[model samples]
Target: YAGPLLEEEALNKAAEKGLSSPEFLELCVWLGSQIKSLCNMEESITSTDGGKDVESFQLEVSSFLREMACPYSSLISGDIKDRLREKEDCLKLLLFLSTELQALKILNSKKMKGSHLEKHNEVYQEVQTICDALGLSNSSASDILPLLTNVEQKIKDILSKVQNNHVGKSLLTKPLNSEQVERLGKINDALRSEYECRRRMLVKRLDVTVQSFGWSDRAKVKTDDIARIYQPKRYALSPKSTVTLAHLLAAREDLSKIIRTSSGSTRENTACAINKV
Candidate 1:
């Protein structure tokens, strides 16, 4: 389907909505797993384009990347451009592990084997039924896991460069088609509605990345320190139970003055008060 060229306006307007969307966070967690899956593999494999589900999963991620990419702006440097392209390619490798692939993973699991659009077709049911009836005899096309590992770092780096960029048109670019913009726009809008849920999901998924990228060992994200990002800002004691050190010191000084002013009999009482403190 034709979409208007992704204009900067849409991305500038990119909503942080749905960060907690199960599907979106699930995808993010899936992405971290993809990185590790690629890293552990012996080689990279590719999937042949297949069912509608594959198309849907691919579109969800591709739309996100295209929205994040900046093909029209002069702002991104050559190294960054190449990195973005590599990131896009890495995401495609992740698709090889898609749920559609998992369903076809077993020989007995039905997958649509033939097109209903063909001449003299026997499976005359709707495409959905057609999809439901076919089964895999043995395999998925190829595993691209190893190839994905090679570019994971590159993609992460590109994200670092672009994550904070959402200010002016000249500084960013989308230049995407109508369908992509529209679909992603809705996602951004949905985010504003259920942000708490999304944030929780986002954190859970991002936490997985720490293990995948070995961030746990160093308390960092690539070159950047992430100890601050993952940590919640909380005091060990309650505000009502605590006083500033300065205030405590000043109060102690006043107590000392009271002890100095006390007569011999009252001095004993003041000493007890100081001892209690």
Candidate 2:
């Protein structure tokens, strides 16, 4: 199939829609894992286009096409690009989704032997059957799908052994998609932007306050030190910086006060508050 070039406008469109679809997220995660697998390998597997004797190249490609079909659309759409650049949360989500997808791949690898592993194995077999039936077993497709089921099942067993068993639960229950992840990226970006603006305003206020106290800009008055004076663990309490949060809170409070005070007075104390506080 012909793929579209990942144009800026297409990327913008994907970003605007936001990855709100759970299917999309799952698809992205799968693609990521497959790409990683394709990129990394033992030296022997790298030289030949993966085993040449097992099956006809066209047949192998066709078998892998089913798995490959979903992700290429997103790549062409540029959904992953914007989502990746958004924030830590998106990265975490992407990684989590990818882990689940890899788990699915592992599950598809091993043949059905145990009762618990039966369903997953069946799915893998079914996918292979479908590929054969659909005439998609071509050499042009990657070989990932034939083994995807077994790989994903094995990963499931490993995940079940984790201390935080919630990983499996979340993967099994969460219905997130590409559109949703894209939406999350937007939300994160908005928060980041707001936080940055407030942070900068607070920094400016702090600088003016220090200057008003007859301290030169060269005289370093670390915000952490200021917060520590108030409470020793103030900054340590949260994973992030309390001093930064405090500055933003104070800046907001000061703004509210100035707005109230400036309602009737033309010569407002806004400057004084910024400089003297």
Candidate 3:
């Protein structure tokens, strides 16, 4: 029932064809089983059609991504691979969003239960811990982190509503209200400080992560540096004798100078003999 609603109608068409075409029966059976499994789940399954209700939506979206991951695995080539990667990215985003939302829900629930609003710092710290454990990747964190600001605003709005209700009604005398106002101011200050610190930390990590795109190039250059250029010498060394081309050139120059300096008949005869040779 939910499968047809959640999945496209073509799934049902395929199931009908499965009765006549044996080739499609396998897919039909698998899809039917998947739907049956979902139906068999206890009523605890949230009926959040596309996650409209905050709690119900989160639960439903989480379950939806897990199920979508199945057909995503069947993708073998072309754009499907990209789509699969996108789905994976979406999964991570959902995970982060759901984790944070769930945490905020818990915190708000506790606050609503009269546990004391002073413990918001502890609650924020716990949320930070959960974020770290998730080991978020660049591909997903960008898409997911933005939702945090929205959720944060929602939290602030809710908290403000709670405080407003408490402050209204003239429940406290002027002096007591003044003292409570001071405490509330301090709490807000502490929360602002924490949010600033967390934002800076996230920014620093994002900068490093962005720089990592070039890190592979840096690694390649470092590897290439290990290889020195092969320089070719003009002459080779003989056993126990290191003879460079400079030595041969110098010797030839000396011989040429000797021949040039000679000017007598003997030199002329010698030059004539050298030329003949």
Candidate 4:
């Protein structure tokens, strides 16, 4: 990481001229910039320290680190005042701080990448679900908008057909005599009653089914749930069936080997048969 290089440069400079040198001040400024950038603070650290005395500058830096809740703030602040003038001690503290800040930057980058990946996966899954509902192949991400458009067009077509059917029925009824209309009305009422009776019977059956499954009456039962309830338990494979399955698998491998090694015409015929199946 850049931490080691920065520390080495700072140490070399400090060894030549001591901790109170311009090199030390530059290191402090760099550290301040890093902290501010990482925390997204608008205030300039150098501007805040301009014209301040050594004690005031130290206090400001310590307070700023504390306020930002920076990692290792307590340890760094505690050492900063006592070790600011000691070249070796000051360099060590700076090295630790720089390493920690660099680590924090890496972690933040990874978190951002992970969050973006999760969002992309969620969107992809949602698109795939939509494609499945519309019975479309989700072959590529570029197909998403076209799939949605196709679904919208299908809905529009269905609604248009329903409207036209309703209009046609109305037109047909307009030419009917009053007696015929009254007879049709009676028949409609009888059919409605019959349907209502059947609906009630189905509802009761559904309630019984729900109770059998230990589900609440208000709980929704989807097609898959009903299928699950009715699905037969699979028995363990018998020795004979196991042997048959192994033979089939072996045959599949042999067929694959044959397809790979066979002449062009034979390979094409096998491929066509596979596609047809």
lDDT tens readout by residue for model 3, 1-277: 2333235455444434422333233332333334435334332223323534433433443354444443433232244224223434333432343354455557667777665444654555545554555442223333335545555665566567675554234322234356766776666667666766776676666556544644686655654342232112211211222333223323432243444446675565667654777
In the range 1-277, model 2's lDDT, one tens digit per residue, is 0122136454344433434433333334344545546433221111113454322322322233323442423222343344333434333434454554566556655333464466656665656655555445433333446455545665567667777634323222344578976776666667767776777777666656644654445435554465446345333333222333223322432243434545646546445665566
lDDT of 1: 0.38
Model 2 residue 61 CA deviation in Å: 21
Best TM-score among the predictions, by candidate number: 4
Stretches of candidate 2 off by over 4 Å are 1-44, 47-185, 211-261, 264-277
Tens digits of per-residue lDDT for model 1, 50-80: 5324334434444433433424332233333
Q: How high is each candidate's TM-score? A: 0.15, 0.22, 0.16, 0.40
Task: Provide C-alpha RMSD values for all models, in order.
Answer: 31.3, 26.6, 33.0, 24.3
Question: For model 2, what is the C-alpha lDDT against the true structure?
Answer: 0.44
- The digit string of per-residue lDDT tens for model 4 on 164-216 reads 44422221313556797677667666766676677667666765765576454
User: Alpha-carbon error at 152 in model 1, in Å?
Assistant: 48
Q: Give the best candidate by lDDT.
A: 4
Off by over 4 Å in 4: 1-10, 15-19, 40-49, 64-81, 136-277
TM for candidate 3 is 0.16
Off by over 4 Å in 3: 1-176, 218-277
Model 1 C-alpha RMSD to native: 31.3
